[model samples]
Target: MSTSLPSAEPTPSPSRPALRKILHIAFWGVDAQTLARDIQAHALTQPGWTERLHITAHDLPHADCLEAMQTWLTSELQTSGTRPHLSLLVPSGAAQNANAGELQLRNALISAGVSFQVLYGATSEERIRNTTNAIALTAKAILPSSERACFVVSDIAKPINPRMRSWNCEKCSDPECEHRLFTGLLPA
Candidate 1:
């Protein structure tokens, strides 16, 4: 008669919970309102894990876009009260089809001390290449098949200002620096 007892099976460990969800944002010089709407729409439309929506303004085009973004950021920052992980879609090159509005957006962001990472958008190839890694990290990467939510600031209404052309204008002045650089032109 065998006296040896059957070896006991080892207890299995519980699986770990999934990490915080991340949403991938691809900017093509889109304004903040449109971007926000797109992100919200994606959250509603896409099927998969749920994660909070956010944005990182990379090299953008247009002052208006920045302004709109600032409005969104102000709300988000106030609510969240901290820097959130985000990605920015920027033109691949200065000579590309990038708009002046996009350039203004980037410049304003830099001046405001906002931070973001650049994802190339010069060509389909480059945009694809830059986005691959970001998309992979997300639980669900989404894009509108026909109309992407991203819209250039130039497409939005501009904030009109009369003294934007004047360097001495308070609108153009920078409190942080002796020399005032054009933060961005008021919507116009």
Candidate 2:
């Protein structure tokens, strides 16, 4: 009798899909105080969302911008009677190693007694998209689906090059850009 050959075992594949990073954005108007008040009021009268508000400002440089963000948090404290948890995501600057800036943002939040998280080195166009995606996913977990979200697209002046021109220009010509899909997803 001939000996039979042994069979090889099959390798198993991953059970779940890898999670994509999406930006969870909360858009506030120019008036942070008003926006904060409205959000806090909702938390007080309504039970759908946490009084906690998360903010992500892309490429912001002004003291006023910081103030506005702070205003939003302060309003939540005054109206809802508690400080909201905070997280910040910042893009890497020209130097590529922009973790310093991200640290500054985190430190600012900590100084204010707010818990925060910061993401850095997202300077490239591709990286920016990834970081934003990460934010979206994070926001979805904390906020409700019905909540309106917003993001600030800062200066496109820096990293001025042919490649960037192509990227931005493609958005105008291409219909598949995330901006288009994101806006379309919003309920009227």
Candidate 3:
């Protein structure tokens, strides 16, 4: 009897490394530092989040917020930076407006060369509550249950002058100590 030819073994292909997962949270009319602190204090306190998840907070400009976001995304892409999933917090209003804003923002990001998937529309709320429920819900989608976090954004009244400068009595009388602006008050 003739010997049968030996069967060839199947070769396995090399597996690709998994991409790093990141979450980016952007807030309008909220201080970046406060948001970051709240997220860390409220959300990251969970167990698994300390190791697997990473998050960043940004304070969006009231005007042209989308455009600024686009620029930021473009820079990150150009620099070969990791593109994290984005979430936006906006004021509560008609669903139509929210939808429109979402589309425009999505388009802006895509045009700016973002490669990662952008999920969910804007989360809206009229006022800050004890816990930012909407943000927590959104975070839960991508992060583990323990890592979901939220924030309460309180508005601060604008000072008489928002600008900053060194105080100089020669410039004007009654220099606004906070901003160093001359309030035009007559010298007492």
Report the C-alpha lDDT of model 1 over 1-188, residue by residue, as the tens digit. 00111112234447744333344343434433334333444334333312323333322323466677565445534544444434453443543345666566556556556555555333444444334334433323353332222221112222232221223544445454323234442342
Error of 2 at 147 (Å): 5.9
Worst 10 contiguous positions by lDDT, candidate 2: 1-10
How do the residues 1-188 of candidate 2 rate in per-residue lDDT, one tens digit apiece? 01111112233349844332132232211222232333334333323223223332223233334555455445434543334333433333332343443445444455667654433232344333443444445555665565424322133223211121123544555444555546756896
Assess every candidate by TM-score.
Answer: 0.35, 0.29, 0.35
Q: 37-65 in candidate 3: lDDT tens per residue?
A: 55445445443332333445443333356
Q: What is the lDDT of candidate 3?
A: 0.39
Sort by lDDT, top down from the best: 1, 3, 2
Name the lDDT of candidate 2: 0.37
For model 1, the stretches where C-alpha displacement exceeds 4 angstroms are 1-19, 22-28, 31-82, 92-96, 134-188
| Clash numbers, per candidate | 13, 12, 0
Point out the worst 10-residue segment of candidate 1 by lDDT.
1-10
* Candidate 2 RMSD computed on C-alpha atoms after optimal superposition onto the true structure: 21.5
